[model samples]
Target chain A: MSIHTLEVLVENEPGVLARVSGLFARRAYNIDTLVVGPTSNPEVSKMVIQVNLEGHSLEQVIAQLDKLISVISIEELVEGAKKPVKDTQPDYQN
Target chain B: MATTHVPTANGTVMNGATSLVKSLEAAHVDVMFGLPGGAILPAYDPIFDSTIRHILVRHEQGAGHAATGYAQVTGRAGVCIATSGPGATNLVTPLMDAGMDSVPLVAITGQVPSAAIGTDAFQEADIRGITMPFTKHNFLVTKADDIPRAIAEAFHIATSGRPGPVLVDIAKDALQTQTTFNWPAKIELAGYNPKIVPDNQSISDAAALIAQSKKPVFYVGGGVIKANAHKELAQLVELLGAPVVTTLMARGAFPDSHPLHLGMPGMHGTVAAVTALQKADLLITLGARFDDRVTGKLSTFAVNAKVIHADIDPAEINKNKFADVPVIGDLRETITALIPALKSALAKNSQDLAPWNASMQKLKSTYPLGYTLPDDGSLSPQAVIERIGKISGTETIFTAGVGQHQMWASQFISYEHPRTWLNSGGAGTMGYGVPAAMGAKVGAPDSTVWAIDGDGCFQMTNQELVTCALNNIPIKVAIINNESLGMVRQWQTLFYEGRYSNTSLESKRVPNFPMLAEAMGCVGLSCERPEDLDATIEKAMSINDQPVVVDFRVHRDAMVWPMVAAGTSNDEIMIARATAPDWDSQEL
Candidate 1:
């Protein structure tokens, strides 16, 4: 399993976090750390999820996450979280 | 907008419940199955006066399964409703069933007041939280105005893409709160776009592989049925002239009687079909996920076959077996494109499939499906099921509960059309047959629908017969009464040294199926002898005014053959007791 981080942008709606994390729990994918909070846009939320999985399984996870209606887009944090998170976003764990 | 005073063009401002009814009407929902409780009572008020027919089922599980059945037959989202807490929780099985089988289902549930939510108040449950993993998508409606949008989106999500269950849990307070009603609500799903068109490159690659391969098999699965790609699949089959094998969930996706058909594959599949896959050089996997049941000991299955896996769901591709050419998109469009590409490829350099065709024909004709009569000389479940199919013809929609009877129904029946067979394939839910058959009848009133159930499975959700009787659904039910959980008993005998344990249902007579059927206001019949089989079946078929139940007291010793034990390789299939078919000649 390789460590990888993803930045997912989703709608600032109820149960959006559950929808994201619940997918991992159900599909038996591994998660290292996940943080979710409000973004610059009030209507959107930002999630930085770190997972320890194979490269292909990561793609599968991302593809499944992309299927959630609330999720707008996802980007792999290629540089690996040079900064933990933006100051404007709250420190939330899920 | 929350409007208590303002009036719309149609009438006075309505509550969330009334708005939901109007939205459902707009969605063209002619029938819905549901039950009412405290939180859902407010919604029942508007439904009382609406044009949409509400089918009151005895249980919420029935409502959910009924919706799935309706969706499977109608190719539309089946709608079900229930109250909060227990009522909503009861629908969990059906949600999982729809999720497993990719049936389009819209489930509307009542939640505790938004204020009472997360408080463990009376009848309060986080239905949205409970079902988040099972549903394609879900919404917890707090604002009264969100009801219409949620309904619209739920309908859209449930019926689109891969077509699975969607949940819209409405807060009780929202339903009671006054809200402006709107029609043609906008769907705002930003990240839910499913790819309908495949890349031309992948299509061309798949075509090239198919054209050059001497031994190729069309490994069909349930996605073909969900995608409604039978016409395109037929066209592709005619173009390639390859042997086709449909999976359990895909039993009716391809015509069973087609000249190149190899029957079903995997565990409990036909010898020819399984061998063809075991020996194939290329597998043209179309809309079929390589399910564990179909690909027993995945490493050993189709080991020689180069894969051309095509599916609408991206996750399914390469999830199990590696896809040599992964075609990701809606299968109808993918196959539609591949047909022409394959034609051009065939025009270039087509492999001589004559040798492969001869081998497959030899396999199919040599090891045709057959079963021996029991020593006690009772009715055979296979014969009864086959006769049911033969008499009713392909026009009849057949649904089965999970067990030996389900296997018999899948194997015995000849399916020549799509959407003609429905079963709890992925979830393998035991009580799926009766309610799904009821739903199928509601969706297709002109055709005959039969629920072929085992005695063990039938008892789980048989209470829905009362709903069928009251609603004028004339679906027939045939209970293959083997007197026990026959599948379990078979495993016990095979693996557990015949210790039996708790696998006895006391076959002689417990709760007489015929009497129970009559009690439920259905025309009940029982057939114990072979001579009475046709007469009883014909009688069941003739009854068109009310629901009918016929219990065929089949021999309890019967077991499903062509067995590949769980986690074993498909190469080790047993055609019958102590018999493995000759596989030496399968050079392909």
Candidate 2:
């Protein structure tokens, strides 16, 4: 599988991220990299997620992300980029 | 659009169109579902000219539920507007439902002008404070200028973090003030920063632990679904060769078809998944709060595993079961770091779990999900759900209320796609199906939605039927009526001293739903005979103009199986009825 970066824009409000994250959690989707911060628009924020997914499922992720009420937009930045699966694994260090 | 000044007992006040419309537009409101009343007439004028669409609702509850339905399906903040007193109070049920389900909603209520606040004047109530605990944040717009900012902030707060409903109370006077309109560009809420980021050190430490473990498993929850991290989760699972067992809310986070997918592991979880969790060496929990339903008897849950809990909410960690490694940050960030950590840590004393995997495989085959079809020609509810799944396809959304129906749905319905099945998981709220189904249908107008509810749950918020009829929203309501609160009855029959009380609705004379539906301007179908089930459901599904409620008169004594008796472990589930003639014919 190839690594892809997903930049999601969401409404800045309560439980928005939780709902978004919960979607991925229940699906057992792991994040290779994730970066979240304020956007140029104060009413919105951006989340940068990196993962390895194939064709149809990648489209599925985009469709699901768009369904979230807080999510404004979703962009697939880097796709079909091969990264060593063993080299880049999701870590929970917070 | 001009304000009309009026003299009140306490002070001077004004009511006008420009003030109310300006604030709504400033708040970026695109639509509102409500009815107009004397107390809210000033605000109605602006709504007519503004770009925002105003949907006239038959009942205040419908306005609230419709907003909830819209918000839940769109994932956008939902807005509902209503007048004071009964209008405002009518919204309470839907608001509470939204709050309980964590749906982002901004509810606007009109009050008598500031001079008459809390004096019990015709349409006056202290709605702001009354709804404070139920919302993430709330505001009372006393000044016209404050109205714009309040609306803007309401949207921001309602949609941010762990999303929930927010109320904005505007007096009729506030809707009359005219000022140079400038919407606030930014919000600054002191001590409330909803953003989350991962700490690098914690990431490194978690990576080290993963590298050290020989047998590791992932315990996922609803948070992954919220973050849209299914691909990342799949990547990690494949990379680490880890098996994942999701909680109820976490359903569909992992592809059910994936080999490493252990399915839901909890009170009602599959036997293999639960057994695997019990013997796992390392537990990597993501986004899920380990609630009692999933943990079963906590002492025996994942007893052999060392836990690494990663959740956005810090309070969730160690709230129940203690974790050896705690990662409190955005789940997306934590997973990004964990991917590399686990990859590098591979090849550290791997244990051969082929035997264990084989044993789990055997358990799955031994206690497979099963139900009996009566030879006497009785229709099985499980079969009905399976039929719906087959005809509707995986993408068609299924919304359910709490009870035996929910369990049966979860068991029989195959959810291949994410977010296609919406149910009350954390708070198993009854009366959730009809409203949530209404909301889901509103969100995805293209898809056919089903409100698969039990008779007990349907009665709780059946008032939404009028909402469905008025809006012309066509949704199917499949009521699995066993003439009793089936779950409670099951418990009473098995262990509650065999004394069933108040569980039977038969004595009350089940509502004449067919007559009620016709009165409410919708088609209604009822079937007491088992043979009529399939054809009736097909008839209900074909209707496209208004909501359809099908009351399935099921056997009262029928009970959901594979039940973990009170105080029993997940291993000791009742797969079938005790009095069944044969074990094979009894349960699967």
- Highest TM-score model number: 1
The CAPRI quality class of candidate 1 comes to: acceptable
Go through the candidates in order and give each one's DockQ. Answer: 0.33, 0.02
lDDT of 1 by residue, B1-588 (tens): 111222242344889889888878877789999999999899999999999999999999999999999999999999999999999999999999999999999999999999998899998988888898878988999888877778877888888778899999999989999887755324556667777788888999999999889999999998898888999999999988989999998888889989898899978999889988988999999878888999999989999899999887877767788889988888899999998999999999899888998989998888888798877778988889989999999978999999999999999999999888999999999999999999999999999999999999898999999999999999999999989999999999888999899988874488888889999999999999988999899999999999999999998888899899999999889998668887675555
The Cα local distance difference test for each model comes to: 0.88, 0.71
Quality class of the docking in candidate 2, CAPRI style: incorrect
lDDT of 1 at A14: 76
Candidate 2: tens digits of C-alpha lDDT, residues B266-310: 766776567667767888898887777877777777777898888
